[model samples]
Target: MADTRPALPPLRDVIARHGLAASKALGQNFLLDEQLLDRIAAIPGPLRDAPAFEVGPGPGGLTRAILRAGAKLVAVERDRRCLPALAELEEAFPGQLRVISGDAMATDAHAEAGDGAHIIANLPYNVGTPLLVGWLSAQWAPLPWWSSLTLMFQMEVAERIVAKAGSDHYGRLAVLSQWRSDAKIAMKVHRSAFTPRPR
Candidate 1:
């Protein structure tokens, strides 16, 4: 079947068109690089036709890549300013994308994305750690709700997550991240990768 979806505007153009300036209060850093976004979306391996969930999908960059990879995506965005842009994505991808407007911290991701969903996101910096902890400790019947987690965090937090015992960075997050599942830093994103780049 020929893909009839309309061509998407460049990420920067979309941001400008939508007036989406990354909000520091929200810990927003809009990722505009398509190749990079595609790489991040592929971190959990093949997601073809699988269920995928994204948190803090500012401007839907990663959301586009997930859908392009053939996953059915459910994205939760706390920033209403980005919803119009996301709605555009919904039109372009049709049934492939479903977006929820609310705080990811409060959302039951397992309920929204269902069992075995691949949870992937750039993750808003302010709430990333707490959110990861919640998912890691969800106490499911057999396993956690999601099959895998591919998330982006600030370098310090990432280091903490993969830190070894006795290391200064090793602590509760490190234990939780490694206790039940294989955890590793799949990639490192430079400050330049984000708009209004992190300080």
Candidate 2:
């Protein structure tokens, strides 16, 4: 039988239609590399039927990868500017992709995710550290929700997350992460991979 599903427009076209340009102040950097996003999505272990939570899913690059990987994705994006782009992704995936337009930090991901969910993202550099701390600390509190975290930060931030005691990067972040759940630096992406590379 011939396939009759609507084809997704090119990402560039979506970006252009929505006027979605990388906003430095908003910590926006559109990931142009599909392979990197796929690798990031794969790091949290098998998606299968598990729900995946993504923060700052600007332009839905990583969001698309998660959907393609066969997981139900709930993406929280802060910028209203990108909501149209995300809406396109929601259309592409139908019921599989749910996008919330709001501040990721304030959104209760657990409430949206229910139970047995995995968190994965190419975190916005501006809020990455604080968000990681929030997630790690949440795991130790009365209501730990997510089963795992597979996120990307700046290379320096990645080092800090996986750093061990006595290592140069070791600090409160290292202690908190180690004290809670298993975590690691799953991958490193180059600056050039982003639409507006950060320096």
- The residue-by-residue lDDT of candidate 2 on 116-166, one tens digit each, is 789888888888888888877765775567888887788777778779889
Worst 10 residues of 2 by lDDT: 3-12
lDDT of each: 0.92, 0.82
lDDT of 1: 0.92
lDDT of 1 by residue, 121-161 (tens): 99998999999999999974456778999999999999999
Model 1: CA > 4 A from native? 1-6, 140-142
Predicted structure 1, TM vs. truth: 0.95
Q: Which residue pairs in candidate 1 have backbone atoms (N, alpha carbon, C) closer than 3 angstroms, thus clashing?
A: none
Candidate 2 C-alpha error for residue 7, in Å: 3.6
Please tell me which predicted candidate would have the highest lDDT against the true structure.
Answer: 1
| Per-structure clash totals for the candidates | 0, 0
